[model samples]
Target: MIKKEWILQKALEQFNERGYSEVGVRELARMLEISPGNLSYHFSKKEDILIALLEQFSARNSSFYEHYLTLSPTNAHFLELMEKIFNSQYEYRGVYIGNQYVRTELQSQDRFDYQSIATKRASTFQKIFQGLDAAGQLRVNGEDIAFLVAHITLFGRFWISEATLFTKFPDKNKTIRHYLFLLAKQLSLFATEQGKKSIEEFSRGMS
Candidate 1:
């Protein structure tokens, strides 16, 4: 029997190394040293493979949210969670870099709902912002909190793509750390004095 997990692992590596559209089933099969028919036995189409990959992404994101829900309302907790979230995103860089294209293909296949994913992300971030506001870490009022949540969500979604434009150095770990630092800096700008101190202390510890 074909091992689905092995196909996924190899596919993820290929997707990350080469652009998704550039890697066809034949190319993937050749890379894996398996016949295209063997891959087809497990995944009837490329969309099938992509859907499987997206399912893994969904599960990982759900796990992140579950752990995030357990965090105490503090700037330090938030920064730490930001680090985890960004690191996870970097692992799935293919998703961010070609999100629209992936979603479009998945939608065309009637196998994915991008809007639901987007809605869930918005709701999750809003809750995080609400927790921060309740803890007095956020200086913004309720109205601004909504915008701030959306702002951060947008940044997280597109940060990898943005990094690509100027990240000529190509150190993946350093890029992830830089983005996390940027996230903390953005939040610090809208933080209360106590929150700012917490963030500063967190930064010092990292350095």
Candidate 2:
């Protein structure tokens, strides 16, 4: 990879392995075997790197949102979309792991627009819920859909942080399957009869 890309990748590795606050810019340069001056040329401050990493995450999530718009309308497709969401979150575990740190740091800066990030994420899930409801794959009514969307969004966003409290983190596929299974259970509670049938079949196939 190029120098700038390599810096971001290595920085994420450090952030994920340790907490973001525990890693400093000079330490990052040492980890990279480069001069602190070289690192500063790319990212003057540690927060600058964090912001850049978040921008990469935002692009990924936008791509995920756009992919959903092209999917066939079915409960299965919704699950597929959900899997993509989970996969992206796992891929950027450092971001979610440091969700609080990132938010507090960014919130102090006027340029971050932190609320817009949360708003866009909520709107995306709301659209997904509305789509599923219209397709008869979900039982949520108009008012309930908002609550359901918020519920799913909150769970998906913070799940990694919660998972860290476990005695040990499971293997990646096992972790993802467990998450998917839990999500299947959650959706079953509000699924239409047809939706329930679809989710049951999906769950069995997943097993």
In candidate 2, how many Å is residue 196 off? 2.4
lDDT for model 1: 0.78
Clashes of 2: 0
- Distance (Å) between predicted and true CA of 116, model 2? 1.0
TM-scores, all models, native as reference = 0.91, 0.90
RMSD of 2: 2.0
Candidate 2: Cα lDDT at 24: 92
Q: For residues 3-37, what per-residue lDDT tens digits would candidate 1 score against the true structure?
A: 99999988978776665777899988998899999
Measured with C-alpha atoms, the lDDT of residue 42 in candidate 1 is 94
- For model 1, the superposed segments whose C-alpha errors exceed 4 Å read 97-100, 166-169
Q: What is the C-alpha lDDT of each candidate?
A: 0.78, 0.78
TM-score of 2: 0.90
Candidate 2 minimal-lDDT segment of 10 residues: 163-172
